[model samples]
Structure formats: C-alpha cells, structure tokens
Target: MNNVKVNVAQVRYREGESVCFDLVEDFSSFDLGTEILSFQAPVHVQLQVNNTSKVLLVHGKIDTKLNATCGLCLETFVYPLSLSFQDEWIFRAQATDDLLETALILDKDEIEINERIFEQIVLALPMKFICSAECQGLCPTCGANRNLAPCHCGENDIDPRLAALAKWQSKD
Candidate 1:
C-alpha cells in the first residue's frame, strides 16, 4: 500500500508541461530501520513531475518527524527531517548498465515513489543524533548523566600517562 505514486501515462512529451502533487501519508507502516524508533506524524510530500520524450523528471521535498535516540545520552527524542531530491527516470525498452547511478528505469505507467522517498530520508539522517549542542554526556567514572547533575568523582582522577607530566610541572 504505497502512498506516493505518480501516473505519467497521459503526460505530453517534450511539451515542458509539469504536474504537481501534494500528499500527506501515514508513515507508520514504513520501517525506518534501526536509526529511527517511530514516526511522530504523517509524512508530507510535495512533488513536481515532468516528462520529456525519453525521460521523466521528478523533484520534490519530503518532510517528517522521526523519533531518534541521542548518540551520547541514549535518550529518545523527536527529530524533524526534511529532504529534497530530484531524480531522472528513463523510459527504457530494456535495462542497460550505462544508466546514471541516480537515474531510475521506468517499467510502468505509474511510478511508486515511496521507496525512493524512504531512501532519501535515510540518507538525510545525521551520523550522530544529539538532543542539544550543549548536551553533557554521561560521566566516565560514575556513569551518571552530567547534563542532569554534576558527579562527585574525584577531580584528581587524572590519566596515569598525564599524571607524570603534572608532577614535573609542579616541581617547577
């Protein structure tokens, strides 16, 4: 049950005509993989489709809210994701290896864009998710969240390698 499909069978070729579509799809069924816990709301997609004699061009933006775990604190937080993509789809009689990496082969009159949109969302996800830029991660010694409160771990708990340097500087 894909929510995003654009029918291009009736589109005039090489006329430079364009069709626009806007949809709000329930993304609860789509698995966002391990990076996302759940979707906060329905995904919104805005697309413009154009057909040139041999190629169909689709360009649009996808907006959604994702529940992601913070990398440092391991806390779940809602992250807003917005992605824009432009893809050229070729109307091919047969598949060819020389096709562009980003280009998709059109096999049917209607193009299902749900998979492509999901791919874009996955690619746009950040390598590291953080609740805030100033998030103080858990303390190494006590394993307590530093952002919540300061730990009473000894300030003198310096690395053994650096401890030798500290003694030398104090002697001066």
Candidate 2:
C-alpha cells in the first residue's frame, strides 16, 4: 500500500553519461477522501544524467487533478496541481562539502526514486485544500448547503437580548 517502486532502473547514470526518460506517476492506492485523485507521485521520472559528475538534473512538471471541498461552500471541485521543479543530485561525492548538495543518497542496488521527487510534489500542494475562495459553507442554522440555495431562516436571527423580556411578558 505504501512505498511502491514508481521509478525502477529508469535513471541510468554511469560515471559520465547523460540520460533522460519520461516519467508518468499515477496513484492507484492514494486515497484523498474515499477517492483516488491520481495526484500521488511522478508519472514519469524524466531525468538528464551527467555521467561526468554523476549528477542527475531533473526538470519536469506534472498535472495533479483532485476534487477538493470548497473551504467556504464545502462543494467539491477539481483542483489542478501544477508542480514543477529542477533537482540536482550528485552521486558518490568524494568531497565532504558536496555531500549535502545531494537531495537523496541511494545504494547502488536501490531502484526507488519516488521518495526524493515525491517530497517536492507534496510541498507544491496547497496547505489548505478548498474548492474555491468564495465557497459559502454549509448553513449554520438549518444545515443547508448555502452555496446550492438560500437558507429559509433570515440572516438577522431573533435578538437573543430580548429573550428575557419576552419571557416576562408571556407570563402575564
């Protein structure tokens, strides 16, 4: 269910050879809210490998389409995800200073590349997912969806300040 290998042996980097491949990522198991939004990870791990310095420069943008409830209205709408980033990964850094520059270090046998790239995509996601800015959330009084229709209750409700006085009059 987790950590499925998305990119396997796609990134080919010799001591000095440049290689790039198309990356397509889909989320079959990624469930945002009881639905698979296909906004999981990189569809393809398209990379340009420089064999000379053992660096893989990645440049690509992905489209993530998912339905998010409107923050105000609570209505669901397709939220388009436009995420693009350029990553520089240097392998086998002989100099200690060059070590930190690498985004992620992997063993020779490790064929997983989703962790490094996936983090970037996640950061691109909106902090608070809403369908739109002007979404009128569910009505507070009758529990009606205000976006769909107007509530029967008046906006200016009965004045609670006069409730005690009304109670006194009712006793008479």
Candidate 3:
C-alpha cells in the first residue's frame, strides 16, 4: 500500500531525471514486543528520488503523532514525531564493491518503503518519554503525584539503613 515506483528505465538511461511522491498511509497500530504502539494520527510521507548515475538517492520525510506514557509522571500524552532520512538504491547491474556495501541493491524498480519508514520512526523515539520539562514525578515517601500537588510527608524521615549514609553526608 505504501510502495513507490521509480522509473528505472528513465532514471538509469537519463542521469539527472527525478521523481517525487506523496503518500498518506493509515498505520493505526503496530506490535512493539510487549506493547502495542498506537498512533494518534495517520502517517504522512514525502519522498524525492534523484538519479546520480551510480545510484538513485531517496530523500524522505515522515510525520505522525503517537501516544506515549511519561517516564516520570506515568501519564499518557500525545507525542508528535517528525523524521527525515536519506537512502541510496542501486540496481544489481550497477552495484560495485563499495556501493553494494553501503547502498540497497534493488532487483526491481519498485520499493516498498513502509518498513523502512517505521524503522526510522522507531529509532528516533526517545529513550525516556517525558511529557514536559517541568514534570515533578511522584513523591517517594507517600507515592503521591507531585505534579498535581505538593506532598505533606516529612522530608526528615529517613530509613535506618540509610541513616549512616545521611550522617556521613551531613559531615561534608
């Protein structure tokens, strides 16, 4: 459904010719191992294919919104994701030692790009999903959400095992 057809004859024969494509694809959900990654909006892709004689360079941009949980606050929020990527595709006949090592060797003129698009999106995801910079997280003493309100627990209360460490800290 999200395939782009590049006229290999046109580009291969003519070195400077280019083609462009715009795709809007519905990818409602994807299985992310233990979690089901759901999207808040449809994925939009824009691609430009350029012929460089040796290879066909594909430049692309993807935009979408996904639901993510805040790492500290544990609240769900919509995360807007935008990513840009560039790839090279060379026909099997034109593939050299270095080109084969780096570029994708294609047997045909058509390319199915949804998998590649998804890969870029997944790699661009943040290691820690924070809703905002001001997230206060939860109180360790009472397990209360600190972002909503301040906790009334005594800050002086310390575990007995950590008391020796606290005492040592106070000395410095």
Candidate 4:
C-alpha cells in the first residue's frame, strides 16, 4: 500500500489552485525496477490546477532537469523537463501510477490530485534519449558503446539471401 494522498485538510488549498514541492527519487535507497531508464537532478515540479467548463485541468511545470538514459547506448544524459501539460481530471476517473498499487480516481469534491501525473512524466521520458548530438551509440555486434570507442566487430555478416551472388559470374 505505497499510496500518498494529499489529505486536503493538511494542506491550505482550494479546489482550483496550484502547488509546488521539491522532489527526490533516491537512486541509492529506492528500487525503481529495471524499466526506470535513469534520473538526473532528482525532480522538482510545479503543478497548477484549475476548473473550467465543469472539467478540472491539471497542469505541470518542470522546476528541474531529469537525466535519462539513451535507448541505444544505455548512457545517461541530461534531459530538460519543462512540462506545460493540461489534462482533464474528471470528477471521477481512473489513471495509472507506477507508485500506486491500485488505480487513482478522483471524487466530485476532491481537489483532483493524483500520482498518476507523475507516472505520465515518467512515461514522457524519451523513448530514445541520446547523450549528445554526436553520440555514436553502442555497437550492435559486440554490445559495446560506440561513444566510448570503435569495436573490431564492425564487419557485418553477409545475408544468406545474397550469398547466391558469390557463385554467379557476370554473363558476358
């Protein structure tokens, strides 16, 4: 039951408002599983909430950076996180959260806070995070990061389909 609900009574807030906080995903203390590519600068975010046309909007802003790993090279790099997101949190709706063992749903009178948004941020962590513009990435043959150095496995094996051409002489 690793659930963190912002008990409205504790925080001085209204239904339509925003809040800010310092965040930290402890690399040394937490086991985020194998899927969590990487993290940089911990994470700090500013969240804004507003009600319009009977829909509660949840917006987010990046107060810091998140260093993520490149999908190709598996090397970590700084990734700017400036989220100007707007999503409708229905008075009663379900959303996924990596931190939540169960789905998060909002009530009619609740301020509409959900850790699922954090999950969305995690999901937004680039599918292919490159360390730099000139990153060479890892060698496919030998499983070595090319950004570090060149590998001897540069020679690729010829496809068997093309091997038939080896015996075919030019017909003059």
TM-score per model over all chains: 0.81, 0.62, 0.79, 0.52
- Across 90-137, the per-residue lDDT of candidate 2 in tens digits comes to 444432466555555444524466666566656776656677566777
Candidate numbers sorted by lDDT from highest down: 3, 1, 2, 4
**Candidate 1 clash pair list:** none
> Backbone clash tally for model 3?
0
| Candidate 1 structure, TM-score to reference | 0.81
Q: Which scores higher on lDDT, 2 or 3?
A: 3
Q: Compared with the true structure, what per-residue lDDT tens digits does model 3 show for residues 110-132?
A: 66667777888898888878889
CA shift at 27, candidate 3, in angstroms? 1.7
- Screening candidate 3 with a backbone cut-off below 3 angstroms (N, C-alpha, C), the clashing residue pairs are none
Residues 1-172, candidate 4, lDDT per residue (tens digit)? 1232333222223455544433334221122454454445555545555544344455666444665677678877777766556555443433335313432345644343435545666566565667778888888778899988888884677777676676564432
Worst 10 residues of 1 by lDDT: 28-37
Predictions in order: lDDT? 0.77, 0.57, 0.80, 0.53
- Scored by lDDT, model 4 comes in at 0.53
Model 4 per-residue lDDT at 149: 82
lDDT of 1 by residue, 1-172 (tens): 5567777766635557778889888765344454535788788999887875556677989999988888887778888989898877776663356655557877787888788887788788887889889988888788888888888896777898798999999998
Which of the two, 1 or 3, has more TM-score?
A: 1
Displacement of residue 18 (Cα, Å) in model 3 is 1.4
